[model samples]
Target chain A: MAARSLGVVGARVVVVAAAAALWELVTRLAAQPYFPAPSTIVPRMYELWFSGPVTHVFLTDDALDTFPPSLGRLLVGWVAASLAGIVLGLAIGRSRVLSDFLDPVIDFGRAVPPPMLVPIFFALFRIGTPTQIATIVFGVIWPVLINAVDGAATVDRQHLETAKVFGLSRPQVIGRIIVPSAMPKIVAGLRLSLSLALIMMVISELVGSTSGIGYRLMTAQQNFLITDVWGCIVLLGVLGYLLNSSFLLVENRILGWHSRARQNA
Target chain B: MLEIIDVTHTYGAYQALGGVKLTLAEGELVCVVGPSGCGKSTLLRCVAGLVQPTGGRILLDGVPVSQTPDNLAVVFQDYSRSLFPWMSAAANVALPLRRKGMDRASRRTAAMEALEQVGLAGAAGKYPWEMSGGMQQRVSIARALAYRPSLLLMDEPFGSVDAQTREDLEDLVLRVCAHHGMTIMLVTHDIDESVYLGDRVVVLSRSPGTVAGDLQVSLPSPRDQIATREHETFVRLRAEVGRLIRGNQLSPQET
Candidate 1:
C-alpha cells in the first residue's frame, strides 16, 4: 500500500514537472510579453509575494493587506452559505409542499451566473464589503442547497423505520437520524461551494474593490505590468489549489468512513 | 397480552393481509411462519403499530395501537439496516432508552446489561457495520431487549445469518423471553426455527395472509439445539408446521 501511494505521488510530480518544462520551453521560444516563461513567472511570483519586508511574520504589510481579506471573505461566505443551505434544505427536502413550491424559485436563482449577480449585489448593497460578501454567498449557496436537498430526500428507508421503531419524536428523528445520514452529502456540497466562493470573490473584487489579491491583479493588468500580472495569476492558482487541498484535508477527516467504503469497493 | 383482531391491510387495490386474527398471552413466545410472499411482515407491522390496517384493530395491553406504543419494541429483518450503522453497539442498544426519558448513566447500564444477555458484552463499543451478520442481528436483539418492553415483535430476525448463527440466535431468543417473561411474536419463513423457538406456531397462508393453523408446542424448555431437534415432540411439530406451510392441513390423528 505504501509503495503504491508513493508511486502515485511520484507520478503526479513527474506530470507537473513535465508540464512546467513544456510551458517554459514554449514561452522561451515565443519570447512574447503576453506569455512570460514559467522560470520568469515563478521567481517573480515569489518576489512579489514573499519578497515583502519581514514583519514579525514572513508577510510584509503589502502581503498582509492583500491576501487575508480575500481568504477571509471566502471563509465567511462559504460558512454562511453552508449553514443556511443545510437548514433550509432539510426543511424543504422533508416537506413535499415546501420542496415543490421553492424548487422553481431556487432553479431561477441558481440559473443566474455568479459574476452576473455581482452587479445586482453591488446595486443592492451599494458596492462595498457587504456587496462583495453577498455576491460570494449568493454564488456558493446553490451547490450546498441543492446537494443538501438531494441528500435529505434520499435518506434510507431503513433509517426512518429504525427511527420510528425506536419511537424517536419528529424533532429527534430530524436532528439525530436525518441530519447525520445527510452529512456526507452536505460536506460534498461544501467542497463544491468553496470553489464557487473563490470565483465570486474574484468577480466581486473586479469592480468596486481596492484591497484584495483580485484588486491587485486588476491594477497590474490596467498598468500593463505584464510580469506582475503573471505573478498574480500564479499566486491565485497556488491559493486556489491550497484552499481546495485544505478543504479536502478536513473533508477526509469528517467523511473518513464514506471514502473508506468507496476505496474498499 | 397482545391482540391482532381481524387485521386487514391493503395497498390501493392489492391486499397484503386479509382478516388476520391472533392473540398472545403474557410471557408467551409465538412464532409466525408463512409462505415466501405472504404478509408476515405486514402483520408484524400492524402489531408494532408501524402500519395501520385498513380494516380491524390491534391491541397491546388493552390499548388500541394507532402508533408505536412506548412499551413495545420490534427487531426487524435486514439487521444490517435496522441497527444504526453510525452508532456503537452500546449506543444502538441505548437508543430506545432515550425515549423512555431515562438518565444517561442508567441507560448505559441497562444497554450494557442487554448486550450481556445477547452474549455481545465485549462488543459494546463496536459499530454495527464492523460486526458480522450474526453479531449485527445480536446487536439488533440487544437493542430491543434494552428497551425493556413488555411486548417484543421480531420479523424474520435471524433470516440473514448462517445456519450455525441462526441456531444460536434461536436459543438466545428462547432464553431471553423466558427469563424476562416478555411476550414475543416472532415472524419467520423457517418451519424448523418456528418449532424450535416458539411455545406456539401460527402458520400463515400464501398472499393476503390469514391464519391457516395455530398449533401448540409441548417440547420442554432449557432446550439444547441437538437434543431439541432430536426430541420426538420437536420432530413431530416441525413436520406438522412444515405441512401446514406447504398448504396441507395436519393428518386427523396428528391434529
Candidate 2:
C-alpha cells in the first residue's frame, strides 16, 4: 500500500512537472505580456511570499499582508456559514412546518448570485472585512444548507424510531442521532463551500480596497506586473489544494465509520 | 404491562390496523405473528407510541401512551439502520441512559454490563459496521437492555441473520427475558420463532389486520434451540399459529 501510494505521488509530480515545462515553452515562445513563463512566475512567487528571514518562518512582509487577512476572512466566513447552515438546515429538515414556511425564501436567497450581492454588502458594511465576509458567507452557504437538508431529512426511519422508542429527549435525539446521521453529507457540503468561499473572497477583494491576496492580484494587474499576477494566481491554486487536502484529512478521521458502514451495507 | 384497546390506524385511505386489541401482563413475552402486510409492525409502533392510531388508544401500565413511555425500548429488525454507525457498541448502548439521569461512570458501567450480557464485552470498542449481522443485532439488544426498560418491543428482530445466528439470537433473547423478567412484545412472521421465543403467540389477520387468535406456549422452561424446537408441544403450537396465519390469508380483505 505504501509503495503504491508513493508511486501515485511520483506520477502526480511528473505530470505537474511536464505541464509546467510545456507552459514555460509555450508562454516563452509566445512572448505574451499577459502570460508570464513558469520560471519567472515561480521566482516571483518565492520573492513575494517565501523570501523572509527565519524569524518569520521565511515569509516576507508581503506574505504577511497578503495571506493572513484573506485567509482569516475565509475562515471566519466559512465557520459562520457552517454553523448557521447546519442549524437552520436541521430545523428546516426536521420540521415540516418550518421547511414549508422557509423553503421558498431559501430558494430565492440561494438563487441570486453572491458576487452581485457584494455591492449591496459594500453598501451595508462600508468597505472592510465585514463586507468580504458577508460576500463569502452568502456565496458559500447554499451548498452546506442544501446538503445538510438532504442529509437530515433522509435520516433512516428505523434510527429515528429507535431513538423515539428509547425515550430520548428532543435535544438528545438531535444531538445523538440526527447530527451524526447527517454528518457525511454535511462534510461534503462543507468541502464544496470551502472552494466557493475562496472564489468569493477573491471576488469581494477585487471590487474593494483590501490587504489580501485578491487585492494583491488586482494591484499587480493594474500595474502590469504580469509575473507577480501569475505568481498570485499560482499561489491561490496551491492554497486551495492545501486547504482541500487538510479538510479531507479531518473528514477521513471523523467519517471513517460512515464509509465502512456503507461498505457493509 | 401494555393494553391495546381496539387500536385502529389508517395511512391515507389504507387501513393498516383495524381495531386490533391485545393485552400483555408484566414480565410476559408475547410474540405477534401474522402474514406479510398484516400490520403487526404497525401495532408494535402504536404501542411504542411512534404512530397515533386513527381510532382507539394504547395504554402502558394504566397510562395512555401519548409518546414513548419513559421505561421502554425497542429493538428494530434492521439493526444496521437502527444502530448509530458512528458510535461504538458501548456508546450506542449508553446513549439512551443519559435520560435515565445516571452519571457518566454509571452509564459506562451499565453499558459494559449490558454488552457483557449479550456476549459482546470484547467488541465494546467496535462500531456497528465492524460487527457481523448477528453481532450488530446483539449490540441492538444490548442497547435496549442497558436502558433497563420495563417494557421492550422487538419488530422482527432476528429476521436478517442466517439460521445458525438466528437460533443463537433466539436463545439469547430467551436467556435475557428470563434473567431480566422483561415484558416483551415481539413481532415476527415466523411461526416457529413465535412459538420458540414467546410465552404466548398472538396472531393477526391479513391487511386491515385484526387479532385473529392468541395461543399459550407450553414448552418446557430454559428452552433449547434443538431440543425445544423438536418438542411435541412446540410443534403443535407452531402448527396452530401457522393455521391461524393461513386462515387469515384465506379470508377476503382489501389490499
Regions of candidate 2 where Cα sits further than 4 Å from its true position: B251-255
| Residue lDDT tens for model 1, B84-188 | 666789988987788789999999999999999999999999877678899999998988888888999999998888999998998899888888999999999
Across B115-228, the per-residue lDDT of candidate 2 in tens digits comes to 999999999999888899999999999999999899999999999999999999998999999999999999999999999999999999987999999999988889988899
Q: Could you tell me which 10 consecutive residues in candidate 2 chain A have the lowest summed lDDT?
A: A256-265
Question: For residues A201-261, could you state the per-residue lDDT of candidate 1 as single tens digits?
Answer: 8878888898888888899999998988888887878778888999999988877766654
Q: Least accurate stretch of 10 residues (summed lDDT) in model 1 chain A?
A: A256-265
DockQ of 1: 0.50
Question: Highest lDDT, which number?
Answer: 2
TM-score of each: 0.95, 0.96
Report the lDDT of model 1 for residue B185. Answer: 92
Q: Per-residue CA lDDT of candidate 2, range A50-71, in tens?
A: 9999999999999988899999
TM-score, B chain alone, candidates in order: 0.94, 0.97
The positional error of residue A151 in candidate 1, measured at the CA in angstroms, is 0.8
